[model samples]
Structures are given as structure tokens and as C-alpha cells.
Target: MTTENRAGGAPAPAGAAASSAFRQPKAVWAVAFACVISFMGIGLVDPILPSLAGKLQASPSQVELLFTSYLVVTAVAMLVTGWVSSRIGAKHTLIAGLVLIVVFSATAGMSGGIGQIIGFRAGWGLGNALFIATSLAVIVGSASGGFAGAIVLYETALGVGIACGPLLGGLLGNVSWRGPFFGVSVLMLIALVATMILVEPTPRPEHRSSISEPIKALRHRNLSLTSVTGLLYNWGFFTILGYAPFLMDLSPLRLGAVFCGWGVLVAIFAIFGAPWLKARFGTARTLYGNMALMAVVSLVIGVFPDNRTAVIVATITSGIFIGNNNTLVTTAVMSIAPVPRPVASATYGFVRFIGGGLAPYAAGKLVEHYNAHVPFIIGAVTVAAAGVVLSTVHRALDAADQEQAHAGHSAQRADAEATA
Candidate 1:
């Protein structure tokens, strides 16, 4: 039950902490496994976008509504996730989320038209908001390692799910556009069962949260600034995720392969690359450099949209930066925000998902009215703007890094004493 410190009683290095991230309890793993499936919903429909447009007789903008509905609903619903979970407890909240995803995803699979599928996806978004917010709280509350380790573990699941989602979508979309939807329904059903059985019951919070708390949390400058920056970053992130497939002009299978490669880099960097870079350069500097690189990558994609090879390579390359940003920014928000974790999460989710929700549809419209290059050029600008917003909080980022390090050391000492 105790983890010893390194020689000379120094706290374990990042490598040791990372290794410990995986050595978690069954309950944690159960939730983590469910987290993987829940995250899969984000990219599960990606490979099917073009297929949906063709088969449903919908325009690309209409098809893009799939992202719009899901993410917009998710953003709005995030305000209530903490309230719901606080009243019902984390276990029931998680189950409620899983159940909704199962029902909605299955219905989406059977929908007769683009409009019907978009509606069902909106319902799916509601479930995602409830599940995603609560899962982070549960993992941070119960995981064996400290906050940093838990984040690493959580991001690992996100990376793996993202990586796998496109591949699964491709294989299934090749069969039928509905295949990915049905696949998610079945998989989420299984994850639901596992979560219900393996995860222990959790009591409701002693102080129930109001729906307004997340919004109120935003009054804190650090929380608000980070949330705004996340919004800008997501504008670029979702532009690529939502709109890039049409440009690829590949088969569903091939598009899946491309995104799967991107996801692989996302996973690798999230788990390993991010922590190493943060330790070396500090959070602000790491994010500055990473976001700049991402802006450059987006610019390349914008300039060379007609060149399939260039687009593919740049898209995949962008994943490394994306992965690093995802982990580091989330960590920074969790550490620096002067509010409870759930509230901070809900607030941040509310802001960021809005940009994500809106970007795909915007991209579609831009392409319709202007050239293919316009949306991505705009995406590159928004990401570069995110870096600028981040700079205003450089001192806060340094403080968060120091705070996390101190927390880590204190946790190690506690474990060492308990063992002795």
C-alpha cells in the first residue's frame, strides 16, 4: 500500500511517477476502460463523415452539424454535470451518462436521415458531458498516484481512445456508415456494465453544487484565462478534426488510417512527451513552443490542402503538438484554478467545447463560400492567438508547476512514512 521514495529520500522522478500511474486499483482501471470507450465517441463518426454526406443526401455543412450538435449540447450541459453528480454521486452519474450514450448512439445508428442522426448526436452529447466531467473527478479522487500521475493516466485513455476510434470507424464505415454508431452502442453497453459492477459506490458530495457554481468559478482570473485560451486552441483543433477528412479525398478506410496515425502520436506524446517537456521547459514555455509548432503545421495544411501527401503528413505531425497541449493545459488548469476540481472542469469544458462545437460547421461554411484554404488559415490564426493568451498567465503557470511538485513531494513522504 506504500510507495517508497527514491534514494536519499528524494521524491521519485517523473519516470517513476509515470510508471506508477499504471499501477492502479481495479476500480480505477474499470473507470479508465470506460473512459476509453466514452472518449471513442469523439472520433467514432469521423471516418463516416463523407459517407454520411453521400448516403444521406446531405451537404457537407449539414453533415458537419453532427459535430455541432454533439459538442454544442455538451458545452451547454457541462454547467449541470457537477450539479447532477453532486446530488446523485459520481457512480450514478457515470452510469447515467453511459446509459444515455448507449441509447443515443444506437438510435443514431438507426436514424433515417441526417437530421435524425444529428438530433440523436445531440442527445449523445448530453451523456458525454455528464460522464466526462465526473470521470475526471473520480479518477483524481481514487487513483493510487498523485494528481500528476492520475492526469497522465487519464490522458493515456484519451489518447488511446482517440487513436482507435478512427480505425474502428473506418473498418465499420466501409461496411456501413451506421456501423460505427452501432459499434459504439455495443461497446458502451459493455463499458456500462463493467462500470456498474466494478466501480464502488460513491456518496454524494457533502455540499451539493449549484448549476451556477461553474459559471461563478470563471470569475477567477487564472481559470477564466485558461478557459479562453482553451477555447481558441479548440477552434483550430476541431477545424482539423471536423473538416480535414473531406480534403483527404480518401476512402473511409484510408481516412481512418490517417487519423489513426495522428492518434498514435497523440497517445505517445500525452503519456511521455508532455511530462518530459513540462519538466524541462516549464508549462508556459512548453505550451508556447508547442502551440507555435501547431500553428505552423496548420499553416502547412492550409497552404497544401490539394496535396494529399502533404496534408496527411502535416495532420499526423500536428498530433504530437496536440497531445502535448492536451495534457499540459489540463494539468495547468487543474493545478492553478482557484476553485474545486469539478467546478473548474465544468467551467473549462463549457468554454472549450463551444469552440470545438462551432469550428466544424464554420469550416464547412468557409469552404463553401471561399477556398479550401480559408478555414485552416483561420485555424492557424486562432491557435497562434491561444499562445498569446497563454503568455499573460506565465507566472501562474510557474506557480502551478511548483505547487504540483510540492504536492508530489508531500505525497511521497507520506507514503514513505506509512511504510516505515
Candidate 2:
């Protein structure tokens, strides 16, 4: 947060030095600006799609691929970028991602053919993947006391970007469908400049491995299940984002309201719910509880798309799970790992992007073959399985924590005896 090493010796008391995220300063704002720029791209495109098609004289279906291509590109980027970041450090990755965003977003604005547009869109995804995976890593690393408060603020920033997308998209889309993305291009350029000049290079430990440590970290039980579940949950999560409009074709107003309203609820509750629910249920239980709700909502929505009221209710209910699931799983990953917070956070992010990318394509297939509803069933079932995996991972973490605590106490006693 301070972008300075408080660990060696700062004038602050031990507790103040420890609680840096609470007072993190300019570095926090710099990272937050990066988040807003990244999310604006992801969230803004939907509102402008119709206008984009009209400008290009493309069909409605063709415009849909913009969303698909973006997700797929971002997913692949996220998975590989982690390995790359682990090698170079988080700051380099963040700056590189911002550069990618600037380049691709500009190209997207200038795209001529359908293929050109898709290519540029895909490029933006790659940039986003980099921004996300590494920005998260840096935030955790710089989060003095650790991930606790840092994650809360990070998610809040994400939620704000997502919430503003439709409003920004609609306003800009009216000016020109291409206008919103060009707006994104401008935003990225700012972020690119800020990141290079403002974001402090994350200090890596001298003992940090060269190229493959993150891969080894991935094999840890807590990391593995958390990563896997993150993927499944996001897979289901993005499906709702991808297909809600189609499901609500009976009412245009309802569709718009549902998507926008969900964002509102998530922003309001993500930080607040963590304390109330997390303390009672614990991380694994809270994560599972959200997944269970996701499954139920998917089923209920899939079954009865006719009732607009039920659909909206389902929409808002699902929003409650969005940020808290993030908080729960991310916190769990750190708690489970002996390696350190940054390592676990980055690893969880990489695999989760894999899930986010693939889910849309898979859901498209299900919708093509069976019913429009089939994807929901498949995603739900998969997420439930992920919940089970997380539960098992939690048991492993509890056992490990007990062992570490015992070892620490034994060491303290031995030190006392030696001194006496």
C-alpha cells in the first residue's frame, strides 16, 4: 500500500506497520485506477453491441462473437500470464497488460471487417487477462497486513466498474457504437501511462524461483481446489452474463433491469456480507453456500423464464454471491498456502480465467443442441462438484493450520528453555 518496505523498520508502531492496507495511500489508488480501466472494457461492450452491428452492417449473431472472442482470449491470457508474471514480477505484468489494452483497444476502434473487429477484441481480452492476474498478485503482495482489507477494496472497485458499464455504454453508444470502445482506448492509454509511471515495481524476494514455482504452487491442495472451484463458479457466473438477454427475450425492459440491478446489489453487499456470513460459515462453507445458491438460481431461472418477477428476483439473488464468492475463495487460497499470499492469489486467478473463457463456448454448444436451458443445468452440476472439492480442501487447511500452530508453540518453549 505504501509502496515502501515497512517490514525492515518504519517509525510507526508494530500494529500500524502491520495494517498497511488500511492506510495504503497512493499505491492503492494507482491499482484501483488500473482495475476501473480493465473492467470498463469487459462491462461496457454489451450495451454497444447493437450499434456496433448496425455500423458494420453485421447480423445480431455476429456481434455476439465479440463477447465470446473476448472471453476466450482473456481466459488463455490469464492462465499463461501467471507463469510469465511469476518469472518477471507483478509490476511488469501490469504495465504490459495496460500496453496491450491500449494497442488492442485502439485497433478495435479502427477495425474494418468483421474478422478485424474480432481480432482486436481478442487482443483486448489478452490485455485484460494480464491486468487482472497480476494486479491481484501485486495488491496482495503490497497489502501490508495481508489480503484481508485489500481484497475487499479491490472487489468494490471491480463492482463499481461493472456497475457503471451499462450507463457508460448506453450514453456512449448513442454517440456511436464504436464510441464506447474508443472511450475504452482512451482510458487504457491513461492507465498505461499511469502504470508505467506510478505503479511501483513489486519487490520480489531474492529466493523467488525463476520460471516454474507457480506451477508447483498450483499442486497444493488448498490452491488446487480453490482454483478449480473458482473456475467452475465463474463458468456458471459468466453464463448468466452471456445469456441472460436471450433468456429474457420476452421483455426488453426486464432484461436490462436484471443485468444492471444485479450489479447494484453486488456493489452494496460484497464487502458487507463477508463479515456477517464468513464468521458464521467459514470460507469453505460460505463459498459452497454461494455455489449452492448459484445452482439453485440457475435451475429456477432456466425452468421458468416466463415470470419476469421470478427472473428479476433470481437475478438479484445471484448478484449477492458474486463478490463474496471472490472474497471467500481468495481468502481461502491464502489461508491454505504455506508459500505466501501473492503466490496463492495469482494461481487462483489464472485457473479461474480458464473457466471464465471456456464456459461461454461450452454453453453455446449446449444451447445449440438441447434447449437454451441445458447450459444452466450443466453449469450448475459442475459448480456443485466444485463446491465438494472446496470442502475437502478446507479440511486439509484446518489440519495444516493446527500443525503449524503446534509447531510454533513448541519452538517458543524451546527458545525459552535455552535462554533460562
lDDT per model vs. reference: 0.88, 0.65
- Per-residue CA lDDT of model 1 for 114-213, tens digit only, reads 9999999999999999999999988877886666778899999999999999999999999999999999999999999999999999988888889999
Please list the residue runs of candidate 1 whose C-alpha ends up more than 4 Å from where it truly belongs after superposition.
1-12, 407-420
Candidate 2 CA-lDDT value: 0.65
Q: After TM-score superposition, what is the CA distance of residue 127 in candidate 2 from its true location, in Å?
A: 1.6
Per-candidate clashes come to 0, 0
Q: What tens-digit string does per-residue lDDT give for candidate 2 at 371-399?
A: 66777777778778778877777775455
Question: Which candidate tops lDDT?
Answer: 1
Could you tell me which residue pairs clash in candidate 1? none
Q: Give the deviation of candidate 1 from the true structure as CA RMSD.
A: 4.0
Query: What is the lDDT, from 0 to 100, of the residue 68 in candidate 2?
Result: 69
lDDT, model 1: 0.88
* Cα lDDT for residue 233, candidate 2: 87
